[model samples]
Target: MSKVEITTQNNTKKITLSGHFTAMDHDQFRAILDDLQSGEGCTACAVDLEHLEFIDSGGLGMLLLLRDACIKQKLALSLTNAKGDVLRILDIAKFDQLFKVVG
Candidate 1:
């Protein structure tokens, strides 16, 4: 199972992802992003992956989806606090080349 926690501060919407990020949780994450897309009025978004435990190719696809969502909504996106396996996966995918990733 996976957990998604969202918070808004000033112009930023932060999404903290926890647990395994697999195909099973795709819809839940999509719904959460949809909610953020619904006139939430944010100018930036951060995905906090510090607590995330695992990810697969489906998870990578979702991250791409998030990137597109942010671009379409004219929001800056950050993938932050990623460590261990999460960080490794992102690095292996070279996602840093595509988005802003921060510790």
Candidate 2:
């Protein structure tokens, strides 16, 4: 199961994603993206992956989608709190340079 909690403050949106980000979590991921995109005015967005347990290629694709969407919308998007295996994946995929990884 996947659990994605979102917290919004001012123009910044924080998405705390946990659990396996795979085919099963596609809907949840999509919903989160939809909600963020639907906001009236958002200047920044951050996805916190510190609690993420497992991620497959699908998860990576989801991240890419969000990144692209944010870029097109001129929103400052960042990923934070990645550790261990998750950090490795982002490094291998060269996503660390493509997106801002903080904390």
Candidate 3:
């Protein structure tokens, strides 16, 4: 199961995710991405995966999709507080260089 919570402050959006990020959660993830894309004048967006327990390849793909969208829109997209396997996956994917990875 996955849970995504979006909060906005100071023109920035924070997406906090927990549990597993898998095919089962794609709908929720896509909905959130659509919302972010539709939001007006957002300066930055942060995806917090501190509480995320597991993520599959599809989840990684979703992250890349969001990153590309944000880049095209000139919005800052950041991944924060990733650790353990999640961090390793991002590193292996070389997404560390493509997206901002914050502790």
Worst 10 residues of 2 by lDDT: 19-28
Model 1, span 1-56: residue lDDT tens: 67988888898999989999988889998987797787367899999998999988
Candidates ranked, most accurate by lDDT first: 1, 3, 2
Which candidate wins on TM-score? 1
Q: Candidate 3, overall lDDT? A: 0.87
TM-score comparison, 1 vs 2, better candidate:
1
TM-scores for every predicted model: 0.95, 0.91, 0.92
Q: Distance from true position, residue 36, model 2, in Å?
A: 1.7
- Residue lDDT tens for model 3, 1-103: 6898998888888999898888787888888888887768779999999999888888888888888888877789899999998888888889888899999
For all candidates, what are the clash counts? 0, 0, 0
Q: Which stretches of model 2 miss by more than 4 angstroms?
A: none
Question: Candidate 3: where is the Cα deviation over 4 Å?
Answer: none
For 1-103, candidate 2 gives per-residue lDDT tens digits of 6688998888888898887777677788788888877866889998999998877788889898889888877889999998888888888989978899997
- For each candidate, what is the lDDT? 0.90, 0.85, 0.87
